[model samples]
Target chain A: MLPTSKSCILCETEARKIYAAIFGGEIPLAVLNRFVVATQRLNANVPPAETDAYYRALLACDDLEALEVAARYTRKLPLLTRKFRLMAYLAETVPETQDFFINDRSNLLAGLWAAFTGGLRTAVKLPAGLWLLRRCAHV
Target chain B: MSELIIVGSGAAGAAAALALADLGLRPLLLDVGHTDPGAGPRVEGNLYDYRRRHDTFGLYIGEDLHGLSDVLTGETGIAKLNAPNAAFVVQDAARLSPVEASGFDAIQSFALGGLGNAWGAGLYRFVDADLAGFPLRAADLAPYFDRLTGEVGISGAGDDLTPFFGATAGLQPPLRLSYNADRFYRSYAHRRAAFLAQGIQVGRPRLGVLSQPRDGRPGCDYSNTEFWQDAPYLYTPAVTLRKLIAAGQIDYRPGVLVRSWTETAAGVVVDATDAATGAALRFEGRTLLLAAGAIGTSKIVLRSFRDYDTALGLLENPAVQIPFVLPASIGRRLDAQAFGLTQLNLVWESPDHGRLQGSLLELTSPMRAEFFMRFPLAARANLALVRSLLPAMLLMQLFYPGAAQPPAQLSLREDGTLRIRGHENAISVRELAPLLGLMRSAGLWTAPMLIFKPATGHAIHYAGTLPMTESPARYQCDPTGKLAGAEHVYIADSASFTALPAKNMSFGMMANAMRIAEAAARR
Candidate 1:
C-alpha cells in the first residue's frame, strides 16, 4: 500500500494537516472554503454527482495515488481556469508521487522549472517560454 | 598492432579509455553491455495509470521481501542498508562471476559500465596520508583527480571535509540537503566545538552528481529516483563512454566478456566468449589493461597464470551502520528535499585508532522500507507507525581503516576456477560504546547498534590484490600498474591499489587507471 499523508515523508505539511482534519470528521478549512467558493462560482448549479465524486476522490487520496487522481480529473478545467500541469509538477517533485511523474524529459523540464520557480507557482511562464523556443527552433 | 585492450568498461576502464583516447592512443573497450533498458516508471499514459502500473513501493514489498529476509537472517552477509536494489538497475546475472561461497559475496556486473551502474555516486580522493606507502603519492595523483572532477562534474561544498576528502575545486553546486540532513548538519554545526573535542568533524560529502545542468544532461531534479533509476543525468561510466564513442575516440565493442589472456612476444592475445551467442573470440593488443574490478581482474590473472595456484589478499574496510533519531522531527510531516544518497560526511581522528570517517545518509524515502524493516520492531505496529519513525531516522556508516584486518584470499583451484574465501572481521559491542556515546553527546538519540561484519567482498571496496610496490614481487605490480613477470600486461583497477583506506575507492581507482594508461601510452 502507498504511504498515507500521516506516514508519507514527502507529503506537504499543510496537505497532511488537511488530511488529518478530514479524517477526524472535521471539514478542512481550506478545502471547505475552496468548496464554498467553488459553489459560489457555480451559482448553485453544482453537479451534485460530479461534486460528490470529486470530494470522495480527494478525501480517498491520502497518498500519491489520491494526489494523481485529484490532479487528473481537475486537469480539464475551463480555459479561464488553471490547468493541472501544476499538480504534474507536484507529482514529479514530491517524493510521494510515482517515478513516472519524474522520469520523462517533459516532466524533468517541468521539474527543473519548478525547482527554479519555487515549486510550480511559476510553471506557466517557464513552459510557455520553452514552448515558444521549441516552436521557433523548428521554424 | 592493435593499440590497447580494456577488459571491463567500468569506472576504471572508462577513465583509462577516455584518457588514452585524449593522448592519441586507440583503446578497444570490450564489455558485456547488456541491453537491459532501464525499467523505470514508463512516461506513457497519465499519472494515475503510471502510478498503478509502476507502484515501486508495492513492487519492492513483493520482490524484495526475500532479500530483506536474507539480510535480517545474516544470509546476504552485507548490511541491509548498503545492499543495492539490483532489480531496479536491470543487472544481467548470467554474464557475471558465479562464485557462491559462504562468508563471501563478490558481485560483478558484465553490463556496459560493469558494476558502476550501481555506484552510489559518492566520489572521494585519497589524501597524502591515505596513500602514504603507495608507489604513486597523492602529489602525483592530484592532477588526475582535478581532471576527473572536471570531467565527471562533482557536486560538493568546500567545508571541513576539504582537507581529508580532497578534490574540492571545480565542483558543481551541491543539491539542497534534505530536511532531516539539514537538521543534523545544523546540530553538528552548533556543537562543532564539542564535536571537535570528541574527535568528530561534520561536512558535506563530495558526490559525482551534477547540481546544475551540464553537457546536455539535466541537473539532479531531486526526484529521489537516484537509488533505483539511473536518471541518465547521473555520471555513470556509460555516460563518459557514450561521449567517447560519440567523439569517435573509443573503439567500443559490446557483448564480449574477456575470459583470459596470454602474453606473447608481439602482443597479448585476449580470449573471450560472446555473452549472447557463446561464440569464442580472440583479440590481440599491444598492451592489455585489466580493470574488471579487483575480484574479476584477479580471476583473469589467475586463469592466465595457469602455472601456479596462488592465493592473493583482497582488502576492504570494516564498516558498521549506526542508526540515530532526531528528537525534533519525530512524528512530524517532513519533506524529503535534495537527493536521497549520502549527503554529509563526518570525519574525525581517534587517539587510539587513526583516521575514522562516517558517511551520514538520510533514510527518508518511502521506497526505503527494505532498510527500515531491519529495525526489530514490535510485530503489532501498523505501517503508519513504522513509517512515522522514518523521518527522524538517519544512518551513520562508520568506515574504519581498511588495513586493520587480514585481507580476503583469492585463489585458483585445480580446475582453473577462481575462488575467494574471506571471513568477516568482528567488531565487539564494547568497542561501539564510545561511538554511541559520542553521538549522544552531540544531542542525537542513538539507537541500539546492529553490528555485523560485512561479508568478505560485501562492501565492494576491496582492493590491493595485485598491489603496487617499489620493486616487483610475486602477485605485485609496478608503480605504473605493470605486472611483475608479465611485461605486456598491466593492471588498471582497484587490484593495483597499494593501500585501501576507509574511503570510497571509485574515484581513486579511476584516477590510477588513467595514470596507468597514460604511463603505458608513453611506453
Candidate 2:
C-alpha cells in the first residue's frame, strides 16, 4: 500500500529525530527516506492503535531521551517481539548510522572501555527503563 | 515417452540422472524449478569493504526485509533461508506444498538445486558405522562417492577426519581458514593429543567448494560473500543438472510439479501440475525415480496410495548452536579475504550419546544487522559491543544422531497437505560438557547459557520417511530402493536412507541415489 503523505511526513520527522538522538548526527535524507519507508512497511503489520501509541511515545521523548526510552522498551520487549518489530525494522534499515558505530580499526583499550561502559549503562538503566516502558507504552 | 522419469532435480535427482546417463539412458527430469532472478549486481570487493562504503541494507537484508522477517516473526533456525538472494530457494515451498507442523519446524525446497542452493557445502563421506542401520554398507556406495568427489570439485585435507570421512580420490586444496578459525585450529593442533585422548577430533572440513578452476567455473576468490550470493566456485546439484541438460543426457522440464505416480502394467504413469498454470498433466515412462526429498517424496507416496491415516517416522539430526569467542582475538581487525563456509569439523565420540558432529564457522559473512536486534544491550551499545566482538566470534553448530523415541512423524492430511508432529530431541548438557571443556582448554570460551538448541528439523537433514529395509513393509523401499507393492518405481533420495547420521548427508544422498539408479538400470 502506498504511504499517505501525512503519515509519511510524520515518519520522516520521527525517523530523523530518533536517528539524531541515537547516533548524534544529521540523518542523511537518503537514509531518512529509507527508514521512513521501512518503518511504514513494518507498521502495516502492526495494529494502528499500537503504532499510534508507539509514535506518540517517541514524540514525547526529547533528544537522547528517546534513545533511552526506546532502548528500555526494546530491552524488556525485544525489538523483534510482535509488539515492537517496527522498532527493530527501523533500527535495521538505518545501516548508514549503524555503520558509523563500528570501529573497524580496533583498539583494545578503546574496545574494553566501550564494552565496560555499555554493559554498565545497560545494567543501570534496565530496571527504571522497564518501569518507564510499561508506563509510557502501556504495553 | 522416455525410458526413465526422474522427479525433482535436487541432489538425488541430479545424481540419479547422471548415473543413468552413464548407462546410455536419458531420463526426463520434472521439477518445479525456482531460480534466482539474477545476481543483479556483483559486490566489487569484500563484503566488509562494500558495506562500509555503501548502504547495503537492501542488498544484504533484502529490499523487502525478508532477511530479518523470520526473526521478526519469531521463526527460529533456518538462517540460510533468510538470505535475500537465496530467498528463491524456498520461494514457493510453503504455499505450493503446504505442511501442517506441530513442534516440528520443517522447511522444504522446490528450487532447481533444492536446499543445496543455500547449503553450507559440508561434503563429508559417511563411514560404515554411520551406515550401520542401512542394508548396504559404506563399500556399496564408495565408488559413487569417489565419482562424485571428482565430478563435484571437493576441497579438503586428509587429517584427523580421514577415519570418519573415508578417503576419496581427487580433492583440491582446502580453503584457507579465517583469522579466528586459524588461531583456533593452531591451538587445537598443539593440544591435539590431549583432545584426541578425550575422544574429540578437530580437522579441516571437506567442502564442495572449488579451490582450483574446473569445468569453466572460477576458483573461489575468498570474497566472503558465500552466504549472501551464489558463488560460481561452490558446487550445487543444479550445476550438475544444467551440465546434463546441456550435454543432451537429460531432458529437463522446469515448472512441472510432480504430485504422485502409479505403476501401470506396462510402465509408470506420473501425475503432475503445471506450476505456473495449475493445469493437470500426465506423463508415462518405463521406470520412475522419486527424488523429491524425503518429505516431498513421502507426501507423493502417501497421496498415491490415498493413505492419510498411516503415519511414517521422520528422521532429522537434533542441532545445537554454540557461539564462542577467543579473548585474544578480540579487537583484531577483520580479514578482508577469507572463506566463510565451514572452516573446521569437530567430531566428539560420546560413549553415551554416540558420535556428535559440529561445524566450526567464522561469523564474518552474514550481515551484522541479523545479530544486532538480538543483543541484550541498548541499540548503540549493542552495536559498539558487536563490532568489537565480531572479529573474535565463531559459531559451532553441533548435530546429534537422529533418535527413535518420542518419534517425529510425517503423515498426509486429508486436505492434501503433509502434517508433521515433532518431539523435542534434547541433548543432555553433560554429554557436551567434555567437548566444551576440551575447546575451552584450546582457548575457545563459551557459556552454557549462550548455547541455543533450535527446535527439531532445524538441521534440515531430513530422511527415513520411506527408508530402505531388508524386509520391506508396506511404506518401505526394498534394499534395492524399489518401493514395496510397486513394480517400476524407485526411491532415489534420502527417503530411502535407513539411518540419519550426525555427518552432513548431501554427499551421501547423491552417492546413494547413484547406487539406486545403477541398480534400477541393471534390473
Candidate 3:
C-alpha cells in the first residue's frame, strides 16, 4: 500500500485540484506535500485491495469536473477518511484558507456574510455534487 | 536512611514533602516521573496569528496526528490530553498501571507532576458544606490553604464566590477575560438579583496561575497556548518538587514504580520496581506516606493486603458541558490578549440537588479541527461554520457533587489488575433546565443538541477510594490519616477523603496532605 513516486505525484495533483475546488485557491506545494504524506501514513494499514480501488477511481479522473466528481465520491467512502483530514489541514495551514474561514470574519457583518455565502454555496452544490459523484465513481 | 518515604510526586506528595522539609526533615519521594520530551517547536505569538503564519501543526496537533484521530473517530470530551507536547503527562500510564473498567473511562498519570501537569488550574478551597462527610472541617484546612496561596501564587477577585471558595490571604489580580466571557459576566451582574433568587452566583475563578512574575516564573503571557505547551507560571507539582530538590530538602527519585509496602517491626519497607528495568527494589523508612493519588494508592493498599474481594468505593464528579454563543460577539474581532484558562466560576445551591459548580471557558485555545470534523456537514461547510462561530463560542462545564453520583466500585483481581465498574449518574435535561433558563435570562443562548455529557471519570477528580472515618475499618484510615491495619503508614492523598465536593479537589488534597505530614512528623 506504500505510495510510489509516480503515484505520489498523481496524489499531489489530485489533492491540489480538490483543495482548490473546495477552498477557491491553490494550496502551497509544501503544505500539499505534508497533507499527502500524512494521508499516505494514515491509510498505510488499509487493505491493499481497498487502496488500489480508490487509486483506480482517483486515477481515472482526467478533467476538473471528473476530478471534482471523484472527490465527492471519495468523501463518502469510509476508506478515504484521509480526504476530510486533508481538507482540515489545509484550512488550518494555508493562509488563503485561513482568511476565508477565520481572519476575514473580524466583524459581525463580515461573519454573517461569510456564513450566508458559505451556507448558500453548500446548499446549491450538494445535490448536484452527489448525483455526479455516484455516476462518476460507480460506487 | 531517610526518615520518611513518600510514594508519588503529585500534588499531595509535593505538599507533604514541603511541609516535612519545613519541620527539618527530608523525605524520599519515589515516582515513575514521566516528563515532557520537549521535542516540539514552540509558538511565539497568539495561536490564531501563528496558525495564519506557519504550517506548524506538529506543535499543537502532534506530528503523528494524535489529536486528529479523536476527531476522525468521533471521540468528544477534553482535548488537552491529546495535545502533542502534553502527551507525556499521561504517557506509560496504561501499560504500567493497567485498569479493567466496565463503564468507567479511567485516566491516570504517572508523570513527575502526575495529572496536575494538564490540570485546568482551578484552585478553590472546600467550605464546611463541601466537607460534609469528612472528619474535619473547613477551619482545619484553612491555614494550609493560605500558606499554599503564598507558596504558589493564586489569581482571583473576592466577589460572590468568596462565601463558597473562602478567602485566601494573598491572591493576585484575576486574568483578563475574553469578549464572550466578559459579556456574560456583565450580563449576569446586571441581572444579579434575578440569578440570586434562583440560588446562583458568579465570580472570577481562583486559579493557581501567576498574574505577576514571582519566584523566577513569568506572568501569564496570554498567548492562548495553555493546552499546547507548559507555562512556567502555571503551578504543577513538579515545579515544587524541582525546587525542593534544588534546595536539597528532599530526595526525589524518578523512574520508580511503587508496587506495595510491608511494615516491619523495625520500620516500613516499600517494595517498588525500577521503571527502566524489571528488577524489584526495596527501601525502609520510619514513616511511609501513600500519596500516589486516589487510584494509585488504592491499588497499592489492596495489593499489599492481598485482598481481592473487598470493593472500595470510588467517587467522581458527573459533568455536563453546554456550548453557547453570545450573539453580540459573533462578528467582533478575536481577543488577542486573552488567557485560555477558565474565566468565571458558577456556584448554584439547588434545594433539590444541593450544590452545583460550573466554569465558563471561551473556546479559543484548542484547534478548530478538533471540532470541525465532528460537525455533520461536509468538510468545507463544517470548516466555514466553525470559523464563523469561533469568535462567539463559550463552553460551560457544569459539575455535579460527587457525593450525589451513583457509587462506582474499585476492586483488585487475582491477576494484578484493578477493575472499575462504573455506574452512570448523569444529570438529566430536567435537572439542567433551570440553569439553562437562568443563562437565557442573562442572554446566553444554547440548544439541547449542543449539550455534551461525557462518560463517567472524565471529570478526573477521583477520591474516597479508602475513606477516613471516626472508627476506621479494614480499608479505612483514621482522621489523622493513619491506616487502620498498618503501622507508621499514612494515607496522605484524596484516597482518604471522606466525601468529594463539586469544586476542584487539588487544593484540598494538598492541604490535607500537609496536615497529615505535620501530624506524622510529631510521631
Candidate 4:
C-alpha cells in the first residue's frame, strides 16, 4: 500500500549492504566506497572530520533517521557542502529505502523548512526529507 | 567660512561634494545620516545567510504568497538604508508631516546616502534626445559623465546602446549575463537585423558596479546578496563617500535635518533641527547646494517661501513590471554569478510615438520562489511542485519615457511642515499589450498575475518639481540651478530635472548635481 512499491528493489538491497557495512564493518564496503566516491563530486570544502562524523551518525541510526542526523551535522558545513552531502546521501541510498521517507508531504515540508530556515541558499539542502525537522526546532 | 554647503549625504550629495573637493574645495555637508547599526547575523563565509534565513522563515512559511511581494517592496526597505518615510532608523509618526496622496505614495529615505543607498545602480547616460528640454545640452554634461563613470567604475561594454547611451572611456567589463538573459541576447542576436529594423534594440545594461576588482574593494563575488544586504563591494554611495572622507576631501555631518534657508548679505543661512536632540541649529555658507532628493529638496524650498506656497511639477515615469518565462530555460538549475540590478536593457522607439525602455532583471535565486506565491491558493499548497517554476521566470520592467507626468504640488502647512499632493498614473494592460507582444515575438511568454500594477513612486524616478527654465518667474530654478527667489541657494538634486526619461535617474541625478556644484564653485 506504500507509495514506495513502484521503486527499484535493488535500492533496498544496496541500502542494506551500506547500512550493514557502516555498523557491522563486515560487508563488501560497497556502499561506503560509493559514498567516498560521491564526496569527490562535492563542490564544498568539507573537512575530513565532518565527513567522518556524517558516516558515523548513519551507522548509529536507520536510513531516514541517519538523513535527519546528517542534516543537523550540515549546520557546521558551508552551504555548498550541506547541499552536496544531503543530495549525495539520498542518491546513494536504496530507492525503496529512499521512498520510505521521501513522500510528497516530506518533499513539500523540506522545501518549506529550507526556505524558512535560510532562503533559496538554505533551501538548496532540501532535495530529500532530511532537512524537514529543523523547522520544528525554530518553533 | 566654507565656500559651499550641501544638503543630503546620499548619491547626489556625495557626488556634488566629491566634484567640489576635486577642485580642492571641501564643502560642508549636512544629513540625518541614519546609520542602522548591527550587520544582521553572519554565517561563516556567507555574511548575509543569517538575515535571509530568519526573514524567509518568519515571513514566507504558510503565509499567503500574495503578501510576499509587499513584504519585499513595501514592508521593509528593499535597499539597506532607504526605509520608506523613515527619518533614519525610527519612523516617528508624530515628527514627520504626512503628504496627502491618491493613487500612489512617495517614500522618502532620510538616511545618509539618501535613496542612493537603495538605488539599482543602473548607470545609463542620457543622450540629447533623453535630455530634450534641459538647460544644458548632452555635450555640456559629457565630461562630468566621463569623470563620474571613471570614479564609480561602471561595468558595461560598448555595444549597440553606445550611440544612444554614449561612449565612456573607463568601464569595467560587464558581468556575465544570467542564463535567461544570455539566452535572450543570443536569440535577439541571431535575428539582430530584423529587430533593429523594428526599432527595438537589445544590449547589456551599463551598471554602476565593478566587474573586476578596483580600488581596495573586491570585485563582485557573485553572492546574490545585492537586494537583501549591503554588498559594499558593489558601488554604493557609502563606498565613494567613505574614501572621500578618509582623504579629508569632504566634511560630512550626520543627524542634521535642514528645515529652511535664507539668503543674506554675506552668505546663505541654513536653519536645521538636530534629530539626536530637539535643539535648533544654524549654519552659514557662501553657497548653498540642495541635493536633498526631489521631494526633500522641494519641501525645503517651499518651507523657505513663507510668504507664499506654490505648486511645482512632479515629473515621474509611469512604470510596469512584465514577467515572462523563457520556455528553453525553464526548470534549469540555478548558478552562482554576479547578479546585478539589471542584466540587459530593451529599448523601443518610434518617430511618430516615443521611447519605452525595459530594464530586464532575471530572478535566479529563491527570490524567484516569491513570485510563485502569487499563484492561485490551490497551486501554492504544493511548495515542492511550485518551486520548480523558479528558474524559468524573468521580470522585465517597462518604463514609458514620454508619458504625461502628473504634477505633485508642495504647499506649506500652518504647522510649519510642507505638504505634497500628487496622483500616480494607473497601469493598464491595454496600454502594455504592444510591449508584451514584442516580448512574445522574442519567444518570451507570460502567464496570469505576471504583469502587476506598480504603485505610484514605485518606479522611484521622481523629478521636475523645481525644474530649470529660461523664465525664472515660471519655474523654481534657472539654468545655473539657482532657486528663483533665493540668491545664494541652488537646487542640485533631481528636483531641478525638467524631464525624467525611462532610464534609471541616479546617474543623471549624480552627474547633474556635479554639474550644478561645479558651476556654483566657479561662480
Q: Compute DockQ for each candidate against the true complex.
A: 0.02, 0.38, 0.33, 0.02
Could you list the chain B TM-scores for each candidate?
0.91, 0.98, 0.97, 0.90
Give lDDT tens digits, candidate 4, residues B1-523: 6689999877889889889988999899988877645334222233123323332321111122221223322232232233221223333322653565445456676776766666678888878888888877888778888999888888888888887778857888888888778888888888778778778898888888778888876777766666555665568677778788889898888878888888889789999998768589999999999988787788788777763456676777777777787765543444345483588998888443377778888664333334322432211122322343445557788887634456666566657555666665555667655556666777788854557766656677778888898777644788889888778888899889888887777888888889999989988
- Off by more than 4 A, model 3: A1-22, A44-86, A89-97, A118-138, B72-74, B374-376
What's model 1's lDDT at A66?
25
Per-residue lDDT of model 1, residues B273-316, tens digit only:
88778899999999999988887888888878874467898888
Stretches of candidate 1 above 4 Å error? A1-139, B43-54, B57-74, B77-96, B366-368, B449-453
Look at candidate 1 and tell me the lDDT of residue A63.
Answer: 35
Per-residue CA lDDT of model 2 for A53-125, tens digit only, reads 6666566545333345455456532332332333333454444654543456857776677778877877665
DockQ of the two-chain complex in candidate 2: 0.38
Model 3 chain B: weakest 10-residue lDDT segment is B69-78
* Residue A139, model 2, lDDT: 30
Model 3 chain A weakest 10-residue run by lDDT? A61-70
Ranking by DockQ: 2, 3, 4, 1
The TM-score values for the models, in the order shown, are 0.74, 0.94, 0.91, 0.74
Give a tens-digit lDDT track for model 1, residues A1-139.
2223244332233234333321223333433333232222232233455434433433443332223322323442111011121121122222343332222222323333333433232233334433433333233
Fraction of true contacts retained by every candidate, in order, equals 0.01, 0.31, 0.38, 0.00
lDDT of 1: 0.64
Model 4: how far is B429 from its true place, Å? 2.3
TM-score, candidate 1, is: 0.74
Better-scoring candidate (TM-score), 2 or 4? 2
